[model samples]
Target: MSDKQESIKQAAIALFAKRGFDGTTVPLVAEEASVGAGTIYRYFENKEVLLNVIMQGEMLRLEQSFKENFPYDRSIREQFSHLFIGLIRFSQENFESIMLINSHTTSRHLSDQTKCDYTSLLTFLSTIVEAGREQEVIDRDLPIEAIVAITFGAVVELAKCFNGGELTLTEDLLETLDEKLWRAIST
Candidate 1:
């Protein structure tokens, strides 16, 4: 959490997002961060370690965003809307983080703990769907895993489109996307 470490993390996120995990190099990240290549080693044990650090940091940020904005007292529909809006907002503001996460999750170097952490977000979403099912608000015909996969997949794809410049992340667009996703899972 020192300035040097943070700089390396930020640079890594951008590079990892643009060039991918395997495509990016430690020296390139060090140069982008304006630090000696050795400085990176001071913070991270190796390239894989640095990548994991960035992934874990982004995942934590995502979880914090959801926890801060989740509407626990609202109707299921409203809660879903809030969650969708939060995701879009997070992706818009932290494009590199989202891309870094997407890249890291697929990397073979990721540790089992990191993989579990990655799925933790999906598990949280499954719980929400489960709650809706209990309330007869969400379709109970599909398994919880399938429901979560479909919902999270749609959001991730839309975010990817925005990141790739195929679409813009606008308030109007988010509202429309939220409604569409809600209808897909709603009973």
Candidate 2:
């Protein structure tokens, strides 16, 4: 990203954290970015497009973080720990971005362009399932598609509860849910 693009992202992150995806507008992002409206348009055709780019970057960052922490030499348990723990840590670090993702997912205004950018998350989770299957930690017959859906749905719903202060994001919670998640995929 150019310096300007980075600046825009930073501004958008703060704004989205504060006002939410639905409440925020392109004009607000342009002003916060310290760029003209035209500049924002030059990079993104509209608010939905800009929001999608932001979401894609956020998910990519999460995937990269998970990859970095999943040491190849780790035990299968350790590997699963790394995967789940990495996700929780990433969520804590990027709470705002996660909130924005949730907001956009529910937003009545979300465009098709914005929704398509979220596909990487499914792929990332599927890779984790595949790894577990290869390690025989997860069920051999557990289809990747089904496990991916289960993981995604569980994470999103649990995250909503956590974010709403209805539940904790503690390590204990992660460990318990990790077990549950594994059980769902295991034989």
Candidate 3:
């Protein structure tokens, strides 16, 4: 990220977090960034483009963090736990940016790559349940698709809780989410 772009992103996030997207404007972002209004135009064609870039940036960061920290060699259960914890850890440290990025995404104008990018919790997690089945650690009768959905879906909601300041993961929300998720999916 260039120095100028990063500064603009930071300012934009702070403004959106405080005032929401509808309430914020390009000039406001520029002023918050301590840059001239024209400078923002140089970086982004419009507010919508800037918002998409920021959202993509957040997903890339989380994907990088997960890719780096996850233990590929661990057992399915261990890996599942790690993924959930990783999300909470990443979100706790990056809530402001993450929340802002999340707000910028909408149902329309969302690319397939971007949709798969920010919220692939299900697709990535179904693999874990499948692994457990292969290892004979999980019952084969359960449907992997629904299991993955319920497990990962709840974690997403929990992350929302953490982001909203309604819940704090005192002992790693992953541990709790992992256990509860496993119980729901396992026989």
Candidate-wise lDDT, in order? 0.85, 0.72, 0.73
> Where is model 2 more than 4 Å wrong at Cα?
1-7, 10-24, 31-36, 42-45, 99-121
Scored by TM-score, the top model is: 1
Kindly provide the TM-score of model 1 when superposed on the true structure, using C-alpha atoms.
0.89
- What candidate 3 gets wrong by more than 4 Å, as runs, is 14-23, 101-105, 111-123, 133-153, 160-166, 172-174
Name the candidate that leads on lDDT: 1
Winner of 1 and 2 under lDDT? 1
lDDT of 1 at 43: 87
TM-score, every prediction: 0.89, 0.68, 0.74
Q: What's the count of clashing pairs in each model shown?
A: 0, 0, 0
Q: Write the per-residue lDDT of candidate 2 for residues 84-135, one digit (tens) a residue.
A: 6676666667777766665566565556655554666666667667877887
Name the lDDT of candidate 3: 0.73
For residues 39-70, write the lDDT of model 1, one tens digit per residue.
Answer: 99998999989888778879989988987957
- Give me the displacement of residue 62 in model 3, in angstroms: 0.8
Better of 2 and 3 by TM-score: 3
Model 1 lDDT on a 0 to 1 scale: 0.85
RMSD of 3: 3.5
